[model samples]
Target: MPMKPAPDAPLCFHTLIHRLEKLKLNYLEIPAAVVQQLGGTFNIRLQCSVNGAEAFACGLVALGEGRGYITLSSKRMKPQGLQLGQQVAVRLWADTSEFGMEVPEELAELLRQDEEGDRRFRLLPPGKQRYIIYHVSGVKSSQKRLDRALLLINNLKQLPPGKEDFRAMLGLPPREAL
Candidate 1:
């Protein structure tokens, strides 16, 4: 039987953080001590609540030696007036969302309608599935989202199991052909 989902107890932390000089990206570093306290591998998905606000899904990007950081986007920071080089309160919980990300309604409906496509998509690793979902949902137009969903699922169904390539899923020519 599948294991029961853990309770929603967030691991809280207050830390000083900084952004890269050349990039708009900001991140929170999880030290080896914190990693050990969390009792998991360096890389893991998390739902982060910043400054007691709403939670958002993110991943802990590993940096070796049991260290990792969660990237914070400008879109999420500007509204809250968050700045780098400031001490911030963060609460993190394991991300338990299906596919580790939100599935766009268009893709979810398409998958519901296409049994073979759904089967192929479900066979893909969670990260790969997130890639497709992100691509489909990135656009603002509903028609465009539907079009992308159809195109991606159609491309996904054509690839052999265990050999699905990201480029192929996007209907792009192989890198060598470029």
Candidate 2:
């Protein structure tokens, strides 16, 4: 079930920012349970009424533990006006499914034959799987994707779910590392 925002949750601006920073994540996962309520994958724009004005933002709905969190970059204009405990109404939706790559036949078969690989593959939501797929597919005119796929598969085979950072596991440097 989706965790509802409390009616009187205090607007703690610093706390909210702290939490966001603590996550140390570039993306936030939207729980699968709430995906439907937010219009599944159709709606893209979210409106938050703030300070007597409407603040609009673009976001991606990602899969979380049990429910989805509507994720917006802190760099967005809407985020600028947000305080910790404001009662802003958010209207959101998933916008696109074009970010990931198709599972290659050879890789698919390899995954199928390896029990651990199969388990990891099954555990990932379609969006995450698509993310990996698309990432692997994005390297054009080189064998980068193939190399990435091999590294990803090996990492998934070694790391448990909560510990995996698909980016780091693929041996990519952190944003700051670049």
Candidate 3:
């Protein structure tokens, strides 16, 4: 069953898209009241719809001008054919999916076929699982997705020391401390 938000949750709203190019943050402004209730977490799992297309998004709510804003990504924008200045009908609730996004079939089959990979993959946190799923799902070609899935499984099988190490597995260098 889908996880429902708290009773009378202020999670439902219609907002206009606003842009923040300098910060690379394009988002809808969420009400401060909702932010307070949500504990001001930037990475809040949301099951939202853009226009009419159903989308699962990780909302980044940032505080500004004594209010709150929910950031949207280009990835979600592209698929939904969203554009700036369009009205976005967003109805958010707590994320209930095993992975924040849907697991691609190509990757799913790969994990099922490889026992070790399946074991290790399930060991990682749901966020990490979503990271791998999102990355592999970005490509168009099934061959590429399979190859990326294989690569991810191989590294995940190694069991990276931490999140930073997990990035290294994906050929990403350690992030510099801010």
Candidate that beats the other on lDDT, 1 or 2, i.e. the better one: 1
Model 1: per-residue Cα lDDT at residue 157: 91
Model 3 stretches with alpha carbons more than 4 Å out: 1-11, 35-42, 60-68, 75-87, 163-167, 171-178
Candidate 1 clashes between residue pairs 3 or more apart in a chain or in different chains: none
Error of 3 at 152 (Å): 1.1
Clash pairs (backbone) in predicted model 3: none
Please give each candidate's TM-score: 0.83, 0.39, 0.71
lDDT of 2 by residue, 5-68 (tens): 3323311111121125566433333444445545455223333323334443334444444344
Model 1, CA-based lDDT: 0.82
TM-score, cand. 1 vs. native: 0.83
* Candidate 1 residue-wise lDDT, 1-178, digit = tens: 2232253777788866767557657888777666665665645677888899899878877756877788888888889898888788988877888777788899999999999999999999888888999899899999999999998999999988998998999899999999
- Tens digits of per-residue lDDT for model 3, 17-75: 87888898678777665565566555666666556666555655566754667678786
> Which candidate ranks first by lDDT, i.e. highest?
1
Ranking by lDDT: 1, 3, 2
